[model samples]
Target: MASRYHEVYQSWKHDPLGFWKTAAEEIDWVSTGEKVFDPDQGQYGRWYPDWECNTCYNCLDRHVEHGRPGQPALIYDSPITGRTASYTYSELLEEVEAMACVLADHGLVKGDRAIIYMPMIPQAVMAMLACARLGVIHSVVFGGFAANELATRIDDATPKSIIAASCGLEPGRVIAYKPLIDQAIDIARHKPDSCLVFQREELAADLKPGRDHDLGALQAEAVVAGRRIAPVPVKATDPLYILYTSGTTGQPKGVVRDNGGHMVALKWSMKYLYDIQPGEVFWAASDVGWVVGHSYICYAPLLHGCTTVVFEGKPVGTPDAGTFWRVISDHNVVSLFTAPTAFRAIRKEDPAGAFIQQYDLSQFRSLFLAGERADPETVNWAIDQLQVPVIDHWWQTETGWCIVGNPVGLGLLPVKPGSPTVPMPGYDVQVLDDAGHPLGANTLGNIVVQLPLPPGSFPTLWNADKRFFDAYLAEFPGYYKTADAGVIDDDGYLSIMARTDDIINVAGHRLSTGGMEEVLATHPDVAECAVIGIADKLKGQLPCGFVVLKAGVDRSHEEIEKELIKLVRDKIGPVAAFKIAITVDRLPKTRSGKILRGTMRQIADGETWKMPATIDDPAILDEITEALKTHGISV
Candidate 1:
């Protein structure tokens, strides 16, 4: 089976256009054209340029039309709100059509952008589908983003309407979203003509007259008026959505995904990467704001006629460390996908594997990790605890889907502890030196993809095509600069070492901070760890490590720090200069569990740093600052 998969991959590499043309036939295109790919058109490639289709029809309506109307399409589980609901294919279609009518009734038409700022509720998914149904471009901001951050996105997108919920239910608290939306509207110069609020009964919000309207009430009115909003057939090149990702310069770039190519690639991924079948449950424990959520939680599973779980609770909160196991066991989830940070948290809170043993996870077949590089320690730990293959894949927000992954849908390959397996069928991944020359095996260099990025990948930035070209395409003439450093081993497996910026130049030798962090994570005392480079006059830069110890493990900070330093020297080599190690109660992270290493570097360098809007806890930053100051380090 593995050989067969490799054969398919080779065929794709040999004839990329033929591969995509075959895949395109699987979708319900309104008018299938002969064009497969256009690479020289304005220098940015476009896929299936002359095709026409509706994304919602491919995701929702087609499944219902094929006599699978009663099949379960969505399973919403929100422990915070104590709600569990299931929607069938037919039911989801009705809800989506009703919401589409409501959107149309509000004077929203094709080509208009709608900003959706809501939690992991059913409405969020419905709103996204409705936008796709009407050919309206939707931009979903992370629910945890601050008003200023939201305002920045609004100003850039200039959305015609905004959809939000009253509040987001977290553990023991309700985060008021309406107030933030209102504040962002006040701050942003380009205001939306309309605001639609989904009033969560747990915490209702005030609606501004003539500006804000009730989403549910509008849907009800549309239903009462017997409005049947059919899916709009849009050109293949029409923009589907705009997702904003942070740039190194502190500005955000809106990555644009088109309808036809995105639909084809995502639908293929559902069966090809995850090995999910119709009616099986697939749960991705990520927020809707992120790309993982956009692909897996909302679109991919539904596109393949599978039941996607929309989880509205944290990995550790609203319950306990066993929250993930419980969700999988209760829902019979076949494929469980999440970040490595989540597993690290669960391992920290319950190290003995006690909580996990309480549940029957036999239904869970494979566990996939992404968002950040998966340390070998965490990957091996999950494999041992779950008794299943833990596959670590790599992709970016710009790509919109997995570029490097183990095709579990075909067969399980030999597990490489630190590698994210081989490149998928469409990605021609290569490691290039700073001068755009290919590097040898085991040599870390910038990760780049050869020209003609696969379907479903972002074609250009929204309203900033030049910025996109300068940021990605222009760096290497015939390659998309990934801005990540990695190496391909002798076995052809790619190991992402670190972000290019995260590589510390110590004594003219490049050291991967991520590699050092992985080494530190192997220490028995360490629960979670992050490494950042600080300016050093003698060595150019030195590695600084922050660690969170396992719960209930009472060990002296000095003792653990000493062990960690030696661990890094032993594993990564003595040249790492990994002397400084500070034990923190918790590492600063975003709500999505990404470590804030940049913020840590700012504090370590004694430079002024503004608190990021996406930070999960501002107090943790203060704690880190105080800890550094206690060590007699100048801050």
Candidate 2:
């Protein structure tokens, strides 16, 4: 279908405030704001600062009060636990109400901060909504993160309390999170006033006598007391949550989301961006800790009065590679959003896509991929298998939503295999050289968005306005530096290649490692691939390719490596200097599925690097180091 994207984008360009104000009317506001945007406020100005509303009310209570009381609001499917549960709007509202009462009972009130560190469970969703219900700012660190990292967030957010789980279930074993939480609290100077632990059947935690309390017991008590807490009214500018970007170190960088803009943007995204209708099943295959999980999995689907799926399992190994298809077929899902890495993993394991045929995906209309570059090979493979529009979109943790995406809701524009279509209505995306001047079409340069970044984007970092400005705004002066390198085609489609630093200098030429990986991924034997530029004193930097082969491939690694090397050289030309390609068991990634390219590069360069706290498996790094040595490529 031909898209009206041009007309819609022009409408936004013609009247930005008018467009947003119209979108804002869809939300139920306690009181409307006098101004759509107040440029005189915030580090970069604020949105709907004068308005009053409850985000929890919009996402939960309003839906129940309105016509969606009996409609499925959330579906919990955990393959690891062999558990499946569904909550209607009424039931979810009751749960959230009880959770709110629990929070209030714990001495929390409006403006208090709390940290939620838990697995991908229903309680995690309830806790977030409960915090929103009481207007307490919540910060969700990744579930089962290392002790020191959690401790850093504990110190930074300085929460009044901590909501955690006893354990997180993996494929083979259970990860006890209680010990990590204990160590984190012990390491941090600012101890929480209380701790609420949700006990899972797999492992029950030994709660500390004075500080810890069991979540089920408290929730049961709250339910029995017949206490009903109304959603607390908060200014639109009031923070809803503080999400620390993955891989925080000494000082945590928390991305703050305000209540009003968050609802306005996410609700709008559900209808217009994702093309999902209310009451329809929409699944974001992500953890509640990440931004995708926070927006799509927990908030957006519900805000739009749609049923959202909370999946407590991996893309594969939750039984087999077909778990995703099983869930979609069972739930009657309309759309599924997930990282490209997941498809890559599934493609690696089930190269023929045989498992996909095992399910009834008649209701599944589309697939959305993000969180990292969606290589063309994987995108095409999905399109071929699902016979659905495989959309590759781009956004950041700070933005909370998409900057560039093929708006499936807008009637998807022509799918460009390498590009994430065009900028959404809110963003004025530009490709700029180091000097801040906009580059011409197809020119590779740093990506930035014009000043007054659209609604739903972060106003400022939590308690660190200066750092926020310095990190995002200061570099480009009048632009929000995305810190990503990409090219905008003549039609304005964005091809995000890599981080700004990932643009490797080959002798005197700058090349994209992502471009090389795209070429390498086309190889039939290759399941997935990563290309990082290792330090080369002679050429300044050289592209190092790591390819993970598909299952049941008997081809020699040497032969596959040669083919991959040739493929990149032919596709990207000799200028890319793509010489080395190696086969590895797997690529090290974050828990969220982003390849640890920087760490891999650092190791290959023999540079001193600390272990990334967010690594999916630390042992993979050792495997990477051994792979590098076998190739006679650095340490």
Candidate 3:
């Protein structure tokens, strides 16, 4: 490990460009670089020049090139049924080939879309790799999504096929996944032509008879073919994956990240930020559907040619919340990354912290917190609890990976309670005001990038290229607006305050309320809706929706709540709709038709309801006040 880091550091200091060139050589490439750097037409100011490589070649085939094909790649566990699974690189390659062949045989050609709605099994990774092998753009929806939410994503992606399992474990219980797929397909406006289901014997929901293709059967057929599953040549700018963002606007945005840029950035980040050592186990408690998983759990570690852990079961449910610590102890993971929310929950559930103390965590060198704001309390608790340096970093779906971080004790600036650490190397960060001009240090403003987009920065939006430029680039010429408000302290550490938009952060992930409101507004009985994040003990903040019923609309509170909740689950995923509150009267608003969401937040917090002069309806304030009292909130 020392030799590897020393070699990289020496190379980086002696000749940075040469270091990149050598690093690039480590991966298998379909097209070698004609020039080390090629900035065609002055795109992003010469940083990323005409770089070329296939993503699959870098992520999967690169290991085989280094003669470590038989090394273990993914460690999976299903706690509900006491099933433990491991996949070696060779085994993974074969499964990837078989899955790719199955897709190709089912009319899934290059550029076709494939949706994977399954648990965190090894097959899920196989499915993703299979798509990459065949150049099929994959959209992986989290398995916890409801039927309606799954249907909406399927409608949006319009994939050629949908892959799922019959049952899977979540939070200790076995869940029926096929029923969700079947229900989603039944109502899907743009249903897939093929549905490949991995049937499990222990399932809660009944499976459909003939409409679904058996995954085992398909794999058997692929084994008989005996043909090599060669990867299709893909351009650097080709779409690698489409991950949806849960924005405040209630309308999810499909963030399209290019292959070459993301791969380069994530790889560099893993090697530098996590200090990944070869042969050392790395565990990141993040779902593959999330950007954390996309960057760290899959791309970064693989690109760096390091061993990684990918548990299929939930962190809390494998016999208790101690499962994570036990796994780390069992696997001897050197670097661990997870949400601060999970750590807090574990702390609350495990008073003795026995599981954490029982493990010899001396091997664990680095710990990172994300997925929601980690308040000072949680950060200090984690550092003391884990007895290791805890690095709380911040980034978003748009940024792709950690843009702000406190390096593993090296070059680490000051520690701020709720701060997002410092910017990474090669990044130029600034806090910009409404005029788009840079603000002085310690001033609050929207966090923006002063220089050209970074390596991990997504170049375009999915089906909304113009909108992408308008939202991120046009508003601030030559700068990318992050839409998040934060302050950079004197020591240069960034403290993320809040989003500039109506988006709510539950745990650490952003959820757009506008998207949920769009679904509610679609219902004839709904007149207006407002959603905001109320402070919570567990999740940092949870979305609390306040809706106004249409005139003469008759609906019970439970019925309306159920229906509106259903609407969100159908429109987005279940993870985005766990909290919804509705009021019968019109929401307090400004004359410009803007909902006074801050006022609502105050009401939810049980503070004295003070109507800002910007509010349009003063009487509506009284109604909201009365409603707050009903919920045991004092005003």
Best by lDDT: 2
Clashes per candidate (backbone, < 3 Å): 0, 0, 17
Candidate 2 C-alpha lDDT tens digits along 1-635: 77878889999999999999999998999999679998889887889979999999999888888899999999999999899999999988888899889889889999999999999999999999999999999999888899999998999999999999999999999999999999999999899999999898999999889899998888977777876999999999999999998752356689999999989999889988899999899999999999999999999999999999999998899899999999999999999999999999999889899999999999899999999999999999999999999999999999999999988878888998989989998899999999999899999999999978888899999989899999999889889999999999988889999998789999999999888888888898988989999988899999999999999999899998898888887888889888999899999999999999989999999988888888899999999999999999869
RMSD of each: 1.2, 1.0, 12.1
* Clashing residue pairs, backbone N/CA/C < 3 A, model 2: none
- Model 2's alpha-carbon lDDT is 0.92
* lDDT minimum window of 10 residues, candidate 2: 244-253
Candidate lDDT (C-alpha), each? 0.89, 0.92, 0.70
| Tens-digit lDDT string for candidate 3 (1-635) | 12243344455556645555654555556675565445453334332345556676666676776776887777775565677777766667777788888888888877888988777677777788788888888888877566776787788788999878777665545667877788888888997888888766676344456556888678867767764678887766677788877442334578877666677777777666776765567788877777787777776776776666777655555678788877777777888888765665565456457677667777877788876566565577677788777888888888788778875523344567677677765456888877988888888677887645655677666777677777788877878888877778777778775567556667776665644554565555554556677777787777767766644556687788787777777777766745556664666754323467777787677666544533445788778778767755555
**Number of the predicted model whose TM-score against the real structure is largest:** 2
The order by descending lDDT is 2, 1, 3
Runs in model 2 with CA error above 4 Å?
Answer: 248-250
Give lDDT tens digits, candidate 1, residues 1-635: 54456887999988899999988876898897778888765447799988899999988989999978998888899988789999998888888898998888788999999999999998999999999999999999988578989999999999999988888887888899988999999999999999998888988889999999999888877767767788999999899999998542477889999999998998888887888887899999998898999999998888888898999998886699999999999999998999999999999988888988899998888999998999998898898899988999999999999999898886767779889999998899999999999999999999999988999999998888789899999988999999999999998899998889899999999999989988898888888899999999999999999999998988799998999999988888888988899998999987778888888898989998888777888999999999889776788
Error of 1 at 376 (Å): 0.8
Colliding residue pairs in candidate 1: none
Better of 1 and 3 by lDDT: 1
**Candidate 2 to truth, TM:** 0.99
